[model samples]
Target: MALNNTYGARLVQQETALGAGVQILLLALLGSATGMGPAGWLTGLVFAVASWAVLSRAVHRSRLSSFGPANRVTLGRATLVGGVTALVADSFRGSPPVTLFVALTAVALVLDGVDGKVARRTGTSSALGARFDMEVDAFLILVLSVYVSAELGPWVLLIGGMRYAFVAAARVWPWLTAPLPPSTARKAVAAVQGVFLLVAASGVLPVMADAGVVAVALALLLWSFGRDVLWLWRQSRVVRQQGAGRVLESVAG
Candidate 1:
């Protein structure tokens, strides 16, 4: 048992170190390609360090025996995201090459589908893997929104900020923490946020058309979230009423 535990620890450390190494390599490439400024370099460093620390802690807590193949795909996607993030941050100083930015984001989005399939095929899916995947997706959307917001109005941030806002609200209203039933519509809505943002960022469409695309994405996201919130609220009320009835019956007895 001690040998097994030690081996697991070593494996986790190696995988995380590999990930950090990839991040550094990516940052170096970006700096050379785009002349990324201090802000971009700093942001990328912070992302790499934070990802290493948090993933290490989470893996330790979960007691994963190995880093797992599916997670490796997700880690690659995260590295791409780190590159996209640095580009966006550097954009404030000067515009990054749109082609480079779009390529990284596009590959990251494509691999989003690939990782889940890999997880299912390998039968290695876990709650931690799903959450990690979701978080990477969410942060990519958030970064894309920030980039687009520079061109569109700040209102564009609503698309990226909405999920985070929901998470924060759940802390205040515990009912919001209830698990939602799987819905295809919800998944589709979540998936499109990145696509639409990517399209807008690519500058392929006319300004008006890009704005329309983003607006539609935001509206769909709003509807999906609203439906889930309503469902959770109704379920919470049902539970409360059942509790109340049980109390009344006990009193009568």
Candidate 2:
């Protein structure tokens, strides 16, 4: 983690360099305390560095408006993810470590929304901030998905699958690089999905008991995506019509 952090052009930035150092140090402490040994420490340190790199960039770019609050919250979220991961790992005995992982995952998921909102509210919105937030989200989700899939046999997880699918499609279709634009409905669905996932992961639900609950949540996400797709299609038509009408008016005038 230290080597990679201080490597390349990224070291040119003071914030990145400093954040990396801090991350490396903390990761060592985290590993030593958790009895995660050298390997686990290295893995966790890598994650910590990644998170620091992102948040530091966001800070340096001045994209986060409510830094006071956002920083505190994100730090908390990070602690939760790392702490719970260790706890669950230690309890490799009874029940699934799914509960700890899920709880940690929830914090990461929730932080996604909180950071965005804070940026908007504090008028600190910027490309750097968005990118930082997005990277954090992608990494968190990816890690959690990998862990979950390892624990619970993969059924049909769109969280990880959708990201890979979109990325692959983007490579083949240049136009896929264009964003589909944000939608509140999509955000709502994402939030709900996280909630249900966390709850199920807590192991609070009976093995067969939460099946209906999980199913319903999945259905909701599907509907949300379907609705948003239709809305975006209509919006495209409207945009095209407006452009055409403007051209005709200009020609006539």
Candidate 3:
């Protein structure tokens, strides 16, 4: 077990290094093409380091023998997300190269489904992997939201911030953390967030049309979250009722 744990830690360290290296290379290339500034580099560095820290901690806690193929795919996706984040941050200082930003985000979104399939095929799925995948997706949406919000108005941020807000709620309402049954509709809603945001960021559509699409995305996300919250609330109520019944029976006995 100790050997296995050590191996996992080492593998995570190596992957983290590789991710950081990729981040640097991509940022350099982007700088050459688009003329990035200190803010861009700084943002990318923060994301790279943060991802590395989180992933390393997860790997340590997981204590697996290997990083696994699914994680590799996720790591690659994260690298793309870092690139997108840098581009988005840089946009605050100056106009970003639209094509590059779209390309990076598009590839990351495309690969989002691939990692799950890989995990299933390889039978390497774990809580850590799932959480890592989810956080990456959420961060990407948040970054894209920031980029799109510049044009569509700050209301678009709700689409990105909703997940984090839900997590925060879960802390106070532990019942909100209950697992939800699978729903294809929920998955579809999540998948479209990046696509819609990317389209908005592309500036290819009419302003009104872009806003309409983002509005739809936000609506679907809200519905999905609301549905889950309702389910969790019901489940919590049932649990409380059952517990009360058991207590009353014991008291009568």
Q: Lowest lDDT 10-mer window, candidate 3?
A: 57-66
Q: Is candidate 1 or 3 superior in TM-score?
A: 1
The runs of at least 3 residues in candidate 1 whose Cα sits more than 4 Å from the true structure, single-residue gaps closed, are none
lDDT of 1 by residue, 1-253 (tens): 9899889978977898899899989999999988999999999999999988988888888888888899999999999999999999999988899999999999999999999999999999998899889999999999999999999989999999999999999999999998999888998999999999999999999989999999999999999999999999999999999999999999999
CA lDDT of every candidate = 0.94, 0.56, 0.90
Q: Give the candidate number with the greatest lDDT.
A: 1
Candidate 2, residues 77-167, lDDT tens digits: the string is 5644544444334444333345445645766776767876776787656566555555455444444443444445465265545555657
In TM-score terms, candidate 1 sits at: 0.97
Task: Give, for candidate 1, the lowest lDDT window spanning 10 residues.
Answer: 58-67
The digit string of per-residue lDDT tens for model 3 on 1-253 reads 7887787678777876888788878888988989899899899989888888888877777775677899899999999999999998899988798888889989999999999999999999988889989999999999999989998899999999999999999899999988899999899999999999999888899999999999999998999989989989999999999999999999999
Tell me how many residue pairs clash in candidate 3: 0
lDDT of 3 at 220: 89
TM-score-better candidate, 2 vs 3 = 3
lDDT of 1: 0.94
Candidate 1: residue 221 lDDT (0-100): 94
Stronger candidate by TM-score (1 vs 2): 1
